[model samples]
Target: MTPLSRTCRRLQDSLNSFSNTFIFIFTTSHVRTSLTPTSSTPNSLLNAALITTYPPLKLQNRKPFEAQIDDSLEQPKPIEETAFDALKPTRLPSNVPLYSMGSSSSPSHTIPVVSTFANPFETSNSIDASSSIRKPISLWPGMYHSPVTNALWEARSSTFERLLDPPLDAPPQSELLTKTPLQSRTSVLYNFSTDYILREQYRDPWNEFRIGKLLEDLDALAGTISVKHCTDDDNMTRPVLLVTASVDKMVLKKPIRVDIDLKIVGAVIWVGRSSIEIQIEVTQSTEESSDTSDEIALTANFTFVARDYKTGKSAPVNRISPETDKEKLLWEEADERNKHRKRKRECKREVENGKVDDRLEALLAEGRVFCDMPTLANRDSILSRDTRLENSLICQPQQRNIHGRIFGGWLMNRAFELAFSTAYAFAGAVPYFLEVDHVDFLRPVDVGGFLRLKSSVLYTELENPQKPLINIEVVAHIMRPELRSSEVSNTFYFTFTIRPEAMKDGLKIRNVVPATEEEALHILERMDA
Candidate 1:
């Protein structure tokens, strides 16, 4: 054999051995491996490409890449927390019976067993034995109690529960047949000056107190006062059930500031056999002084009706006796209001029956004249339709009260917001809340129902050149599309005015005129109110 032939054989053998080693290492390891030319390998393989292999990368307990990307994109934004969130019940009581509208009668139910005066702000560990034994806090003649929880919302619910289950140990009906107005008098103080957290709850964006919140508290307070008058004992375990029927008027006499302390005093001014008339006054301490001499900021009147808890029939309430001259005057005023309400109801029924009174007929005539002649003098008069605004939403369970009905306060807040918007749009300036003339809850709203609020500038008073008053009416309806039914749930009347500062640019507010006879009648009704 030749020497050159032997060397060629040796080179071929070396190349074959190197290739086998590279393949073995690549297949055996679970990680990436690369085979490059080394000093022991042939020089011809130095410039050749390197052999490399990589195993598939795996992550423990992870979603697919596409799924991860989708999840990141679909994540919801965080919601902001508000002070009112605490007012919501953490969980509903399992024992409370749910009322069904379709049912012939309410199912027999019992009140849940719980503390009568549990302080929601205190935890179990913080509540001492002495505190638990303390006398029930009395707001007035009849102290309010809650079964499930002690939140203000629950306190309101206690009154509703009484409508279904009255206390069995109530006093005899003949014992406390009469109650003085002073006996039902009560006052609640909201010390915003020291309680920063409470102030935030009632404060608006402009640092002023929210009148909508005030309206809610006022309704609750009035209901409490009514219960106080009807029940003779402080325990409030009476066989009478009282609920708010209507709010006659709520007038804002002055602007309310959130920085100062506020006080609400209310009493049962008068009572019928089954109805109660309450007067609530809101006052605020003067910012300049530390004394208790507060000035009146607002006044409201509410009417409530009582019913027998078990029979669900009209129940008589204790008669209110007037002692002081002030009390006598209030009683007289309430009597007049009651008479006026009856007359108004009759007039409404007559109009609904297509019988228009002479006053309403005259107003309709004026509306026709305004519509027929749109001359230069009356050019600023716009039709009510042109000054209208509306919004709608589905009522949610979160908006429900303890009785499973939509809360009255929630309705008032929504109506006021829509009215404010209507006034702002009509005036071409930011409108300031002046007063809530009247609110009527004709029917209760249900959860999951479609609610629509329609607001319009009912009329305008340009008596003052600097500031013009805009009267807005908001009508809320529960629309059931499936049933092809739309029912009016509430009617709200609010008055707003453009501040002099907002009208400094010489913006003139156009007068609102009714376009139809119905609208004309509504205008006249408000005028009378």
Candidate 2:
């Protein structure tokens, strides 16, 4: 070989040796320290580590070696590895060198080595990788995915996620790292896009979005808004758990079409001692439409209560002050709602204490409308009712939330569907959703418990025969095995507008007759309220 060719070969060999050494040094020296999230580490220390280890490959000095290799010989394959891959834990191959920062007696400074293929069932309690640990991802077949790596990615993404508006170009990292009070305290805007009607798994050839799915998104948004409101500029307070207490005055105005952008704006409208009311407004827009207007498709007021993570007691949050006329009105409205809730609680306690007034008793004695059969054997009563329906089922895991319980919105969806069926059968027409008067979550429903839902017509206005106003009541009960009885968990009130002209045949409706004073009083209480 010529002298030039021999020199080129020597340079390529030296380059390969340097590449291997560089990978080994970083992988062994720093992998353990970087296993945990960098968020917990000091910013200066993290910056120093990044500066020391970044760009392991020096590409600027490559041109001399790049042209020296003969075209006839096979070129070396480019290194497709990344710095992140070195951080991934894998089983120690036993032949690999055991690394340490100092002697064994001074173990505090040792560089801990961990395997990527740790047991999936083992629990990791500490961020210190100094002591090797963990569990198998799962026992089921094909369920051995690495949760450790997944968690690391999630932590990294959340810490560095973009915080600016979508349309605006992102600023430099230096600008983004310096967060301001205004950035911390801002209304959260959530945008979700889906071709709901065209996707086979998500849709059923329906043009409008599913009420259940929409409600789930709303519940999630409510929690997000609550967190955003409760968060402070200091970052001293950690995120607290918030539960949905009630949903009121949810009005579905227009049908949300397929392949549309469902935009939601959620903000804290009112705050009480420990509970906050978030107003979530949903609007539907599409890329094809020229209408830049924001038309609300649905809107609801959701009340949530923050709970201390450790004590599980009601936690106080920062109070909000109204600055604008609209804000003042919402604040007053929320105050009124809080007062109403307090009054209802007091009334319930009064009834439990046997301090019922004579006026309430008199309302019970008056002839009131009810839909329940007088007796289980009363076939005539069942046949006469046209606007009542009942169904029962066991709550399964599929309907459960991360809290391991059935979601409030799932119950609402069930109630709405049953009520719509009853209304459709009675009116002999298509029932259009108007509004949800109230969805009071009295108690949490267990995942595996028997859920019994009863939907009945509370009131119907026949003054306008063509267009009738119907109010439906839905009550959910969970069967208590130990007590041998069912306890009420939730009550949903829905209002719908239906047209009698849409009926195929002439359908005659019969008025509901109350079988007992208690049932009559219950119906009357809802109607009067």
Per-candidate total of colliding backbone pairs = 0, 11
Q: Write the per-residue lDDT of candidate 1 for residues 159-241, one digit (tens) a residue.
A: 44443344656643555467788887877888788989878888776777777768877776776677767865544445576
Candidate 1's TM-score: 0.65
Q: State each model's CA lDDT, in order.
A: 0.68, 0.56
lDDT of 2 by residue, 129-247 (tens): 22224322211111121222223222222221211111123221121122222222323222225433233322323354556556655665565556556644332334445678899
Candidate 1 residue pairs that clash: none
Of the candidates shown, which would achieve the greatest TM-score relative to the real structure? Answer: 1
TM-score of each candidate structure, all chains considered together: 0.65, 0.56
Model 2 misplaced regions, further than 4 Å? 1-206, 231-239, 285-294, 321-325, 343-387, 482-485, 500-510
